[model samples]
Target: MRYYLNTQTDPAFNLAAEEYLLKSTNEDCCMLWRNHNTIVVGRNQNTLSQINPEFVQKHDIKVVRRITGGGAVYHDLGNINFTFIKVGEQTKKIDFSAYTRPILEYLNQVSVPARLDGRNDLTVDGLKISGNAQHIHKDRVLHHGTLLFDVNLEMLATVLLVNPEKYRDKAVQSIRSRVTNIRKYLLDHPTVEQFMEDLGRYMQKAYQAVLTRFSDDDLKQINDLAQKRYRQWDWNFGDSPAYDFSRSIRTPGGTIDIRMKVKEGTIQRIRIFGDFFGIDPVSDMEKRLTGCRHDHQSIKKILNAVDIERYIKDVTVDQLLHCMF
Candidate 1:
């Protein structure tokens, strides 16, 4: 098997490279990568429902969907991602222990007592430190997972906060686990770079893995894929399923009730109802927001450019944005 250590931190480019290597490359491979302040959601997840919109926008975190069906994961420079693409029949590929063996072995070598608990989680003393997921193809499999070494636990907890009571849908929900950083358990905690280096050496010895570098042509292909798919709003967020959302907020102007049906991450219908007054009904303003993305900045820009005062009297742009997001 070949091994790669990706130095790029752009979430879209890294994710696109994963897919490129998975479907295009013929060799069995193992790769280690990292992303900066990113939320890689599952392919089938409702992106809006899985994230704390305010926190995400406040921190400028990127939300990118992955090609696997698992819960969302928060990644930063402190997190290490590992992927294994193998050529094998997937009919009996449900088990994840074989894939997790190397990680567990490495942990044991470092004197960290870790075990594979439940289906695919790697836990240290019963608290999860890794979450694994796999996707199967005709004769190949893509198994990937996250290793939380020194991730910001505060962001991990705060960023994924969603009021589950607000939306009732058939979308798969994420199961929150009690997570801990691997650095917390190590006596001499290694830096992320050092950890990756040690793991790479171990894998090289175990699998006789050869280190391969991407050529200019390979990166161009990956970047093109990134721009076309991973970096696009249509693929990352617009691909989410339809859902109803309503937020009632008390602003200085008035109590605003914002409700909308979002499909493919665009507002399908929107209604702004409040005890406010305007010369004209808020119909025009609502119509304007129909095709806007459900994100805070996207909708806020639209509201900022329009004469919101003309549509809804006394409702400031900030107030409308608060209710919309």
Candidate 2:
């Protein structure tokens, strides 16, 4: 097995690296890496429904969709991420224990008293410390997980907090659990960096793994993948499953309720209902919104082009946007 400690903190590049390693390489590999403040949503999840969009935009938190199917997870510098890519039988069933055994063993060696809580989580003292997910590509299985070392638990909660009633979809919903940092349970009180290094060393020794680095060609390819797919809005948001969004906001003009059906990130239909008086029918405005990307900028452009007050009295474009989004 080959082990690598990825030093890059860019979430896009790191996620791209996982795909590159899983599909582009033949050797069995393990990687330990980190990312700056970011939210990684599962491939089968609705990205908009999994996050608090206002909080995400206000903090400039990056949102990316991973290839694996699981719940959304928050990542920061204090978190440690691990990935294992192994070639296996194409017909083999998913096995969580096989990939998580080493991690559980390492935690036990550190006196953390960690144990697998369910099919895909590691917990200590009844509080979660890790969440894992997997992806199968032909004969290769890619398993990755997140370890909360000294993460900001408050930030993690806030970013993932979304109104359940806003979106109706068949996408998988993230199960919220009480999570605690691993550092608090450690007797040595080691820094996050130290903990990551120790875990990397343990994995290397356990697998008889040889340390490796990404060559210039490998890095260029990873970066190219990141730019072309990982960093694009289409992959991050447009790939979300079809969902129905409904929201109502009270403005100075009156109350406006927006119900929209979106597929592939494009609005298929929209209905406007409000008590506010208007000179023009709201259906005219709704028609303009159909086929537009369900994004702030795209909606804003359409709102700006028309005299919005004619349809909704005394309401500004920003106010209408607040209701639609």
Candidate 3:
């Protein structure tokens, strides 16, 4: 029922903070705040398939994974990330809506006029402003969410998974149009710092406890854990069970078909059957992908950074990526 507040904005430190809280003492819960521009992928999501590789690389953005189940999201200095850690005891049941109530109340105090729209999303005027996910271990439950306040919507659009026709058809409105931010409703009345202070006060009031500050020892312990597990290829990309996936890609070289079986998020099997002429040794190309992380960034990094020129000629990395994913 206690709270631990982290004001650090570094993605690695923020991630570490969460892991530290999760594994430390279980009963005393804590809430941490992260303010920065970063992209966080879910535990089971494919980093490459879920993100725009070129855009992320060009912007020098850092990518990290959370120990939760959900889609990817973009966080920046304009956004606020919160993590609520509590031991789930029989006396105090863990209710998703109950936990989110405080957030709704806080937003209302700020005149954002937002409401929970779905099981895990908060929307204003029918556009989503926050998304949340959860992780449970033993008697502890961690529910974390992001609050979008004037975040860079353009960067969000660029880095997140592009809305395909199939996904759009599932909803009454397009997914892109259904998401919005508090800035759209703020009218430049409150600055970011004021809002953050107000939010901190609101949380302190809601929890009825003085904020607990984490120390360097706390951050270092958490960072070490996050780096080993959350940022690793096996955990982030290989978390998913083996599945067969096939995609058609268009490249400057030509159209190609990529089919592969992913096991534990790694490329266990693959075949590149395409019309594009092989300017290099295709066998070596297939070998390159095998045992590599099935996620886009890992695969692209291996393909682009490797000295593949010895085997292939006049073939760009994009063409290779187009053929694989």
Candidate 4:
């Protein structure tokens, strides 16, 4: 087994790095890295409905879609990310316990008392400290997880405060849990940087792993992968499957209700119903909104050409967009 040390803080690059290593390497390997403030959602998740879009945009948080099928997770420099990539038989690839056991052993050695609990998570005393997910590609499997050391739990709570009633989809929904940081339980209270170093060094010996650096070609491959897939808005947000969205808002003129059916990230059909007074027929506006992305900018662009006062007497584009989202 070998260990790849990645110090880059870009979430896209880090995620792409894992995929590149998974496909290129023949040896059983582990990747230890951290990312800047990011929200990584599962491949099968409805990213739009799983996050606070306003908060995410205001705070400049990078949202990346990972290859695994699991709930969305918040990542920051205070957290540690680990990946175990191995080429093995199909039977052993889906064993979550087999992959998480090493992590539990490490936490025990450090006297953290963390254990592999229900499904795929590491909990300290009952509060979750880690979330794990996996993806199988042909004959290989990639198992990865996040360990919260001193993550900004306050911001995490705020950013993840998404209203579940807005959209209905078949996508995997994230289960909220009582989460805590490793620093609170550790007696020494080591910095995240120090903990990452110590963990990497320990894994090298415990697994008889060779510590290797990425070559220039290897980095180029990772960068290309990041650019093409990890950093794309389409992959991160637009990949969500078809869903029904219904939201209502009170405006200065009156109340507005928007019911939209979105498929492939674009509104396939829309029906606007409300007590708002409009000189023009609401059906025309719904037609305009049809085929547009269910996004602020996309909706705003279509509304830009319409005479604002004609649709809703006093409602502005921003107000309508806010209500729909």
Error of 2 at 207 (Å): 0.9
Q: Candidate 4 overall Cα lDDT vs. reference?
A: 0.89
Query: Ten-residue segment with the worst summed lDDT in candidate 4?
Result: 87-96
Q: Which tens-of-lDDT digit does each residue in 131-204 have in candidate 2?
A: 99999899999999999999999999999999899999999999999999999989989999999999999999
Each model's C-alpha lDDT? 0.87, 0.93, 0.70, 0.89
The total number of steric clashes, by the backbone 3 Å criterion, in model 1 comes to 0
Q: Model 3, 1-325: lDDT tens per residue?
A: 5667666787766776776787685555657466466778777655555666657767877777777777788888888777777765433343567667888998887678888886788888878888887777777777888888778898888877542421111111213445677866766567666777777777877778666776778766777886787667666556644556677666654566777877666777777765566556667778878998766677888887666554444557767665554
Which 10 consecutive residues of model 3 have the lowest summed lDDT?
165-174
Better of 3 and 4 by TM-score: 4
Runs of candidate 2 with Cα error greater than 4 angstroms are: none
Ranking by TM-score: 2, 4, 1, 3
**Candidate 2 displacement at residue 22 in angstroms:** 0.5
Highest-scoring model, lDDT? 2
User: Once all C-alphas are superposed, what RMSD does model 2 give against the true structure?
Assistant: 1.1
The digit string of per-residue lDDT tens for model 1 on 123-155 reads 999999999998887778888999999999999
Candidate 1 residue pairs that clash? none
Residue 228 local lDDT, model 1: 96
Candidate 4 residue-wise lDDT at 284? 88
Higher-lDDT candidate among 2 and 4? 2
What RMSD, rounded to one decimal, does every model reach?
A: 1.7, 1.1, 4.2, 1.3
Candidate 4: tens digits of C-alpha lDDT, residues 1-325:
9899888999999999989977889889998899899999999998888888878888999899999999999998999999999876465446789888888888889899998889898999899999999888878889999999999999888888888889999999888889999998789999999999999988898899999999999999999999999988788878987899898999997998888899888899998888888788878888888998877678888999898678788998888888777
